[model samples]
Every structure is written in structure tokens, then in C-alpha cells.
Target: MFEVGFWELALVGVVALVVFGPERLPRVARETALWVRKARTMMASVKEEINHELDLQDLKQSLLEQKKLPNTATDNLNQNILRRRQATEILAEQFEPGEAAPEKEPHD
Candidate 1:
């Protein structure tokens, strides 16, 4: 993000070495590394949480669509079943006493 090139980094290192001296430079570098690592980990965790929330919203929308379809399908199925049952009763009444039962076939 800083977009620092090799020359910039070399200049910063030279300045740091002169200002902090060899004795404190390594300790400062170590502390800086630790802080950067912590910041990156925190940022990653935040990103993951945001993504999880977005996924949950998408899942909720999918479930809502699925929920509507099933209700409509169930209502249609109930109407169809009622109509078939009425037709079956009418057919049964028309049959003669000794007539065979209606053929039972499974269809999809």
C-alpha cells in the first residue's frame, strides 16, 4: 500500500540505522514486525466476519425463495388431489356391482 521501491527502503533503513543505532534497531524491527502481523490478523478476521454475514443474507434469500415455491406447489397439489378424488368417486358410482376395481398404475 505504501508503494515504496527498493531505493526508498534502502534510504529508510539507512536513516533508521543512524537514528536508532545497531543496539536498538533489531529490537525496534522485531516490535514493528509483531505489530504488523497483529494488524493483518485483525483485518483478516474482520473480512471473514463480513463475508460470513453476506453469505448468511444470500442463504436467507435462497431459503425464502424455496419456502414460497413449496407452499405454492403444496396448494396446487392439494387442489389436484381433491379434483382426482372427486372424479374417482363419480367413476366408482357409475361402475356395475360385479365390475373389477380400477387399474392402479404409478406414474411420475
Candidate 2:
């Protein structure tokens, strides 16, 4: 940003008045203000669009991380179930028809 002090602004106003003359200066100043307003509007819209895109990217990354966690948990749960089933089968094979089943520690 240019640091235009009060004196510099006064100097520019004086020069503009001289160049544009009393009859045209007000119209020229009004048009310049309009253009500056439009430029600010365009810049604000661009900034908003960039912020929205950044938010979307963050959401996508979170969704992917969430997806991975559920899949891992499901895989671990399936493995645990398989281990328990195998332990039950082994115990069945060791027990005779009329004999009481021996107690064993649960599978890890």
C-alpha cells in the first residue's frame, strides 16, 4: 500500500482540480469512486471463493480419514471373531461325548 499522507492527498486534489477544472472535477471524482467500489466488490467475491474451496478440501480430508478408521475397526473385529470361533472349535475337539469340558482362557 502506498502511504499517502494528508499533504500528498491535498496536493493531488489541487492537481486534479487544476487538470479537470471546476465544471468537470466533481463528475470525474464520482466516476473514480464508482470504479473503486466495483473493484472492491470483485476482490471480496474472489476472496470468498478461495475460502470456500479451502473448506471443501478440509472436509474431503476428514471424510477420507473417517473412512479409513471404520475399515480398520471392521477388519480388527472380523479377526477377533475368527479367533474366538477357532478357540471354540479346538475346545470341542478335546472334549469327549460324556466328559465335562475343561476350562480354558479366552483367545486373545
Clash number for each model: 0, 0
lDDT of candidate 1 over 1-108, digit per residue (tens): 679999999999999999999999999999999999999999999999999999999999999999999899999999999999999999879895898878989998
The per-prediction CA RMSD against the true structure, in angstroms, equals: 9.6, 6.5
Q: In model 1, which regions exceed 4 Å deviation? A: 74-108
Task: For candidate 2, write residues 19-43 as lDDT tens digits.
Answer: 9999999999999999999999999
Off by over 4 Å in 2: 1-3, 83-108
Whole-model lDDT per candidate: 0.96, 0.96
Q: Score residue 6 of candidate 1 by CA lDDT.
A: 98
